[model samples]
Target: MSEKLRDQLVGAWKLHSYVEIPVDGSEPFYPMGEKPMGIIMYTPDGYMSAQLMKPGRAPFAVNDFYEGTLEEYKAAGSTYIAYTGPFKVNEQNRTLTHSMFISLFPNWMGQTQPRVVSIEGDVLTLGTASPISSKGKTVNSKLVWHRAQPE
Candidate 1:
């Protein structure tokens, strides 16, 4: 059954869409614009890393990573999401947990977050298990991914 499956996820996935649905009756918000770009990879040895970003982000005036101006830094920071660490799958419950040891979002650092997983065809959808605070509003995040094809 799908719930008792995990091997299907051991590969690279490319982001298709990301939407944050607010519980307060407001319209859904796109954290990285309508068409975001990202990649998520789950290694065979229980490790995973995800990096997402708004497409067409402007390059900083300075080429250095740590030398960008305040505005540049803020723009880059707000437009991207990233995290990496160990991952565990609960085949019985049909859920996956991402233990964030390195996260761009401060609140997620050293945290383990659960995702409700659904894979249909070549698409994989992972969603937050519960509503979480984001930009001062309660929202649930849903991120869709497509299995990356071998080059």
Candidate 2:
């Protein structure tokens, strides 16, 4: 990992936006809601983990399947997901791969996802390409992160 990337990612980040685009080039917005939150912390020991939260209220709006309507799932309050695993930066590929040993994202369980990240000052944009292309189209999810302020 380049020192540059390390310096930019060492701290924590807060979620700003989350969007899932369909293979048909249609835009579907997913809500992190008013208090959607996330935290990414990188350690000097080369360990990394991230946690993301979505405000609990209505269905995801886009995919009704992810709507955890069960009383238990709803009483769970705001839905929170997290992953703790190994991470690597391939400067040559301009990508970062996170091999999540643990993930709450059902689809991401035991999956390693490579995310392309762009950083500018305190803003970071994170996204990944879709594996299943449809009609020569592609889908992707993008989430914006803002660097946390130092206490």
Candidate 3:
């Protein structure tokens, strides 16, 4: 039986992989490096949160959150992504839009981003609706997620 897209999306999904495809067709890359870890969750109430991190980040010499050196802070910022906010689904085309109430990257804090979404079995694949500059290149982000199983 096929369920509505919204219904299918109301749950937690673990990150399987993430890739960025350059519009110029130069090359696709993974910003978080190999084996990135993350989770994206959607609630029936239309709220959502996503967090992704690069694997094996170096431990900060200082234990305090605010005590990291510039290099350490830069590494942390470049390796982690997080945002939480409300999301809306377009019933006409079954597309998704996420509005960031709070984001790790300040520029996205007030942005509403569109996502091209599809689901196959337990897999959910999300792609950027439009190209965006990333690492000095224009690219579309593709994130594949698998439905989380309860432990």
Candidate 4:
């Protein structure tokens, strides 16, 4: 991978939109709702982390994380997606693969998934290379992100 492209990606990005287009000619679904909130960060050293959540999710009845009821826990889990690990860039194909060391979704743990990547100005678009099961159907996800301003 070219160092220049990698350098361009080493920062935080804010989620702008996320949509899943089903292969079976179904309507696109929004996993995190229309106005989802998320942050994805890539480090120059190759580490990366992503956290996405549905906006306005209800708070658990209990304040403590472990004290939530089963329903609350389920709601929390179902409305969020997170993972972190090392990332690799394929310069030839203009792709990026995230090798998950940890993930909120257990099935993704230890798996490496490639995403087709494109950058236009400050926006970065990532599209799934393969269909993934979401909400009971196989679909390809397309996510757009804007570069985050430093805090």
lDDT of 4 at 42: 98
Q: What is the lDDT of candidate 4?
A: 0.92
Q: Say which candidate scores most in lDDT.
A: 3
lDDT per residue for candidate 1 within 1-151, as digits (tens), equals: 3434468888999999999999998999988889999999999898999999999999999889989999999999999999999999887777899999999989899999999889887899999999998778899999999999999
TM-score of each: 0.94, 0.73, 0.97, 0.96
lDDT for 86 in candidate 3 is 98
Best by TM-score: 3
Count of backbone clashes, every candidate in sequence: 0, 0, 0, 0
Each candidate: RMSD to true structure?
1.4, 6.5, 1.0, 1.6
- Of the two candidates 2 and 3, the one with more favorable lDDT, higher being better, is 3
Q: How accurate locally, in lDDT, is each candidate?
A: 0.91, 0.70, 0.95, 0.92
What are the runs in model 4 whose C-alpha is more than 4 Å off?
1-3
Total backbone clashes of candidate 2, pairs 3 or more residues apart or in separate chains: 0
Residue-level lDDT of model 2, residues 81-108, one tens digit each, is 6888887777666677778887775667
RMSD of 4: 1.6
- Among residues 3 or more apart in sequence or in different chains, the pairs in candidate 3 whose N, CA or C atoms overlap within 3 Å are none
lDDT for model 1 comes to: 0.91
